[model samples]
Target: MAPSRAYVPSILLLRSLLRPLPRQCSLSHRLPSAPSRPKSKTAKSRIRKPDPQPVDFIQRGISDKPGDDVLNESGVSAVEWWEEDASGNERFVSAITNRDELRKHEEQHKRLEAWSRGEEDPNEPEFRNMVIDELKKNPSFSDMQDALEAMKKPLIERIQEGEEVDKEIEAEDEMSKEEGIREAQEFLQNLLEEPSLEHRRDQILEIQAKLTEWNSVDHPEFLEAMARLNEATGGESVEEFQNRLNPYLDIEHTALGSEEEISPQDKAEMEKLAKGIADIHDLLKEGGMDPELEAEFAEMRREIGTDDWATDVFAEDGEIDLDKLERAIAKFDQAELAEAKQEAKDEDDEEDLSPEERANPELKAKIDRIMEDPRLMERLAVIKQILTGTKAFVSNVKSAPDPTTLPLAHMTTLEDQLKIAENDPEHLIALRRLRVNLLPPYNDHPFLRPFNEALRFAYVGANDDVRRVLWRSYLKAKTIPGLIENIPDDAWDILWYSQAVDWASNQNRFNHLKILQKDLASIGRDGPPTQSVGGVDVNEA
Candidate 1:
């Protein structure tokens, strides 16, 4: 066995030695209530389990260490230690005997010292330092989560029983807790009060030679590396990047208390940097957790008007092949392509001699005669009916209608305008000739009202005309009393109507809008409410 560092002076016991030496002590010193506690014989047998490593700590003025044997025959485990400095002063590596009590006393001392120095407020976010770190960091996250979860059951039990406790004692506990939290907060405030390089922007631009003495790198290289990885991933494929960086994530926190690897001063800095790096990696992973939704390209094509020139652009993936596009647009806009395709399909249907085919080339002759008519409206009506219902023009329901039939009515208004442009060649020439930019393309499709509205809103940002339009829509919608209740409550906050109302009110702009004005009648009925807007707080509400 290794020698005990101090020998305890043969007559001294740890608990007893804590008192002043008798006779050499001052007259004012009184005997503490020791309660005649016996040396617990079975206390040695109350051994739990051994740590993978031994306990290690520093105390006020103790340097107790033992060799690898780890413990005495007694239950109290031996401590290990290291020398403090060049002065040959030694420090305790562990305190296993009075572990919990000693640690709590130490924490209390530190807190008292901090309070004496006015370093923190009495009430801040802090818990009992039961084991140095029973509280620290956001407990809602990371490995501490399971432990916090376990505490929920006990806390609920306490809360349930607390209902029966004397109110005064409960209030005292609350007061103590509040004081502790305030102290912690004030301590943080004090630490951050000294402005740094980033805090003093102007001073940072004017660097001084003396400032190098105080230069600090808040983030370590690991944090820098994680940040670089995050940036390189384009903030999209972050999960893959985080998976790649996960190996380095918990390095600094190898063990719950291994943060002591560095000196106290550097320990704080080290853990801060490591935590920041790990947190950033977590955030990167979170940002990309939502999988990409594949675009419904087939549905997109279906939405485009088949006979509209502007729509066929949907079939192409990239920049329009201008010459090819113009040709296709001309055919589509004039319904020529649709008509030719229909004719080809009709001829093919005659192979089996279906009922539609039995009508034969005689209908073809009639179709040609009808197409030659000078009245465009009458010809359009015939084409529309033939496409919508081949049965209407054909006498038999048994007929397999020609799939090649043109759908002139299904064509867009823009297609008709293009045809008119093709005839006149000069009217609205500016609109006809204007090209799409591809990026944020202008909505020029005459029949696509919603798309036009979206483009108009995007281009104009927020305007009074849009507000008025939205207000009228809201009025119409709310006029049906049940309609408002039908809308999901979740949508109420972000609803466009709410935004438009806010914009119209300009709640923060003109004082007259939010405050009372002298010109009540002249302000007009639509100005604002005579009192606060709808009796709401008008600021917070």
Candidate 2:
């Protein structure tokens, strides 16, 4: 329905030919008049542009506006235009009407051109000046500048100062080591010369202080002095010195391990002592059992008639049947009364014997033989000392200010006695008695508290066998609810030191120690549900 493009040129040519030529005769008449006279003086000519017309209304759907259709189709409101000035030179009119927008565009264009030329933009100077002005308005700007200036120092000078500081530290460390060695030597000399208990105690305290300051127990000079001191003190044969030196010594070697080869005479004496120790063990075991008490208990059981008496005594609602319990208690009282009467009768029979009859020849001969054997006599002396020490310990524990109170000095004395007892078979029995009597009711006492002073003392003063017992006790103590939370840092340090000693002595597996060390390192990092001290979890312990 539209005309073909090929006919458009011919149609335009026909229209141009149909147009009439304008009045050629009138042009010839006007041209003759204009050429008749030329101006006497030349004049400059000026061209003036007409004023722009103002429109009252704009049509929305007009198609005659140039580029309007294209702008509507592309969704653009306005575009840049070109306009002729009065001098007939073309000038560009930007679509943006805002002066600030026009200035920003001009700056962006300059920045792009500068970047292409690998040069800094001209606008950056003005921007940097503006930023500096803003920073100057801050209250602390001058103070910050001063601080930065003060912080500036030459690298060489700082390195030199650091080196000097390191030298001073090295000098101090050397002086400390020398002082510790000298003090330790003096202590050892005084202990060797005097060998008195009071002198030894004071010197030992000094040595301990020095060791603590040095932060190492494995110093060569200290170890040598300690060895000499131990020899002079009779190598754990003297209980006081053993207790004082135990925290610094290898417990396995000094307290528990076998001695080196001895002379035949000394060996004979040792074997005799060994026999005596075995006898003591047998005696203690026999003394622990009471046939009368056992027989009474058996009779009581018979009287109670083994028919789930507990159920009969306690009703379904957990109330005790008073009649049945009273009958059972009456039977127990009768058994105890009979036992008491029999004991009194035996005492009277003993009193009826004459003095000479009481001292039988067989018993006298046995006693005389024991007195003649020096080894047995010496063993008996040690046992007497152990008994005396145990009695003193019990007295001290009972005389404390309160059930939960134990003075440190008294605890030290008790620990010394325990160490002495631990070295002999008879002494171990006494230690067990102390544990049974004191540990249960007075557990809050510092010396008897679990994983505290008690465990530390046991580790230091007792042998491997006793340590195993204490460790088992410690593990058991952890099983009690709320007990783990009460464990202190010192307890974990002691345990870690014990494990370290065990590992060093090749008594513990390396993998076990490794796992323990890892767990200790992870304590505060990945904390477990249970409380931990020194990185060891109570549950794991």
Candidate 2: C-alpha lDDT = 0.44
> Could you give me the TM-score of model 2 versus the true structure?
0.17
* TM-score versus the correct structure, for each prediction: 0.14, 0.17
TM-score of 1: 0.14
Off by over 4 Å in 1: 1-97, 115-541
What is candidate 2's lDDT per residue for 70-155, written digit by digit as tens? 43343454456566766888776445444455456577567557667879532233333333443443443655755433433332
lDDT of 1 at 9: 54
Q: For candidate 1, lDDT tens digit of each residue in 1-541?
A: 9876864354556657788765753323345466344369676566444442323333311355543343443435544434464466765433444455445657767886887798843432132222224332333244675676564444444433434333633464355445433433343243235453235433222222222332211124433543443454333243333223212122222111100022355345434433332332222233221121112222333655353323333222112223332332233334444556766886877577766546445544544554464553443343344344533434544665455684754343544544444333233222222211111111222323332233233222345544434333333332221223222222222123323245423322232222211122222332233233353332333
